[model samples]
Target: MKISEELKYTSEHEWAKIDGKAATVGITDYAQDQLGDVVFVELPEVGQMLKQKDEFGVVESVKSVSSLYAPLSGKVTAVNEKLKDNPSIINKDPYGEGWIIKLELPGLEEATHLLSADQYLKALGL
Candidate 1:
């Protein structure tokens, strides 16, 4: 499993790449691998507010359907519309082109509580 050192993680397998209160979020490499080929993604619209741990969207893969959770409280600033037509990109580049959403964080403090790369790996028993 590929864990990004610069990104913070959630126990549920989401990753948040923070930049000046803006966070680009997505499922971890391990998550996409387990999900198999992604077929659909239901994303939150821009301007939608989300609290930490909130169910923001859903990802349907060949293997299963899973809810996408918010790792931090924020307003959604962007969604990866590209996934709508070609969800398989998630299988191709989960941390790059497959990133699901971007959030405008309410505060940076919320980010601090998320897992580090090592912590996330440990949680996976790696």
Candidate 2:
């Protein structure tokens, strides 16, 4: 599985890039691969508040539907509107164009608790 060295990850296979007080979030490459071709995505509204690990949305693939969790608490500033039309971008570029949300974080308290790229790989036994 492809993993970005700059991102933090969750045990659930989500990845985050924290920059200043904001973050970009998405499923890992491993996650999209396991899910097969994605058919649909359910995204949260832009103003919604999410806590760490809260179920924020759903991703429906040819194989299964998976719940997306918040890797850190924040106000949702944006969602990937492109996914509504072509969810397969997730499988194509999970760390870039496939990113799911942009969060305006309150602090890094929860961010510090997340897994590093190396730690995440170890958790997956890669």
Candidate 3:
């Protein structure tokens, strides 16, 4: 399980890397590991609005299908279109090339509610 010190984490297992008012979001390494060999990703369109904790997409793996949650209230600025053709990239590099979406954050302060890498590790009993 890889946890990025630079990113914020949610209990539901999403990670967010904030850059000013925009954030890149993805399922964590732990999440993909649990899902087991991702085969498809169903993501929202660019320009869609998402509330914090909303089910923004779904990830389907050989083991199961799981909902992908929003980490903050924002408009989606971009989606990882590459995943449509090669969803297994999420299993290969979840924090890098496998990032799911970029969101235009309306309240950067809401990020304060997110867990740090240490906190997220503790939450998982790691």
**What C-alpha lDDT do the candidate models reach, one value each?**
0.94, 0.96, 0.96
Q: What TM-score fits each model? A: 0.98, 0.99, 0.98
Ranking by lDDT: 2, 3, 1
Candidate 1 structure quality by residue, lDDT tens digits, 32-98: 9999999999999999999999999999997799999999999999999999999988889888999
| Model 3 agreement with the true structure over 10-104: per-residue lDDT tens digits | 99999999999999999999999999999999999999999999999999999899999999989999999999999999999999999999999
Count of steric clashes across candidates, in order: 0, 0, 0
How many residue-pair clashes does candidate 2 contain? 0
**Predicted structure 2, TM vs. truth:** 0.99
Ten-residue stretch with the least lDDT total in model 3: 1-10
Off-target runs (Cα >4 Å) in candidate 1 are none
Give the root-mean-square deviation of each candidate in angstroms. Answer: 0.6, 0.5, 0.5
